[model samples]
Target: MSRKQYSKELKLELVKKHLEDEISYWKLGKEYGIEASIIRRWGHKYETFGEDGLEKQNADLCNYSAEFKKKIVLEYLGGNITSQDLAAKYKIHAPSTVRTWIKQYNNHEDLTNSRKEGVYLMAKNGARKNTTLEERINIVEECINTGCNYASTANKYGCSYGQVYVWVRKYKDKGIEGLYDRRGKNKAISQLSDIEKLKAENRLLKAQTQQQQMEIDFLKKLDEIERR
Candidate 1:
């Protein structure tokens, strides 16, 4: 799936709603069809670095000095904060970059400013690689242990970033049972408890209702514009 890019204006608007209006991230996420975690991260960034934190980072402008990388890496290793928090605090684009630096430091690898030699600078989109259940479990464990660093985990395991992210999410939502490949098997409603089925249906219905409401509001604005 293609990643969606939000404009700075939209980001500021959402961040304001989250901060000034005291809107909950979960509510905003459901209403706007974005992850609550992502919204929360945006709020943190906005708080830590102001509007500049919400600005989209240009890859060309991401060059960091080796000394800077070492400083951030050491701070992370100190365990005072999470990688996500560190990224927000330091204005880094991705927490995975911080995790990658920590991994390199722990492995006694050279920390260089050269992007060519940087593992974290690899392409975000990569070919999906098939893995055994054991490998998947290990990958998910490492990802969780490393503060959910999907990009670095994906790079280390030779899989796509999406795969690592999805696997980790599934693991969190359903535990070990979620890791099993049930593609060809029937996903019958009988497998779910009554409460589980009802909850799932309610979530779907809520999303649909919200979507319809947005559509109606959009059409109303269009009609009003036409009448003027």
Candidate 2:
């Protein structure tokens, strides 16, 4: 899906929420229509320039250039600007260039931005995430594209392999709503009880097999004595 942009008022409101500790960075990004990570950029905007961070920003922070990428990013952040709108203004060929720039801004400092477990910035400040299913469809596609096995995908997403398959397969069949965890909606599908029952049955079967093997061994010993 294409990204949505935020207005000046909206940006300021989200920043207020961040400063107030009322909304987490990730949630604020969702509310303001920016990526969760971009809160870091907003925070940097606040830290370097104070309240001016919420203003319609312009210019670059890294090279000390007055021509900040902020204005272009701000428009795109509103989530309405089309890829064509972006290419013309930013003189970039790809819409994803704008996305990469925003990601850069987000890792800047906005500590208020929320992150999941195992996501960290490398030396280059680029991110590597230990996948969680915040966006189930997207994550499942990633796993498929990467050719990872289901168990591996489960490990990455903090779910069981069975769950990864279930969510992804449901999304493939039914679309986004299918990704909403149904574990709460139906206990029968939750599998915990079923798994426990199977475990109990398996224990009983194993004990029966062990007893039969002991009997067989005893009979073999008796036969040996008879032969002797």
Give the number of the best model, judged by lDDT: 1
What is the per-residue lDDT of model 2 for residues 17-95, given as tens digits with 9 covering 90 to 100?
6644447888877775678777767654443333323455343212212234566555655556754678666555345
| lDDT for each candidate structure | 0.63, 0.47
Report RMSD for candidate 2: 24.0
User: Candidate 1 vs. truth: CA RMSD?
Assistant: 18.5
**What is the Cα-based TM-score of model 1?**
0.42
lDDT of 1 at 177: 57
Worst 10 residues of 1 by lDDT: 116-125
Residue 50 C-alpha lDDT in model 1: 37
Give lDDT tens digits, candidate 1, residues 147-222.
Answer: 4556556667877554676677676677655666565343443565778656554543454455456556645744
Best by TM-score: 1
What's the CA error at residue 78 for candidate 2, in Å? 40
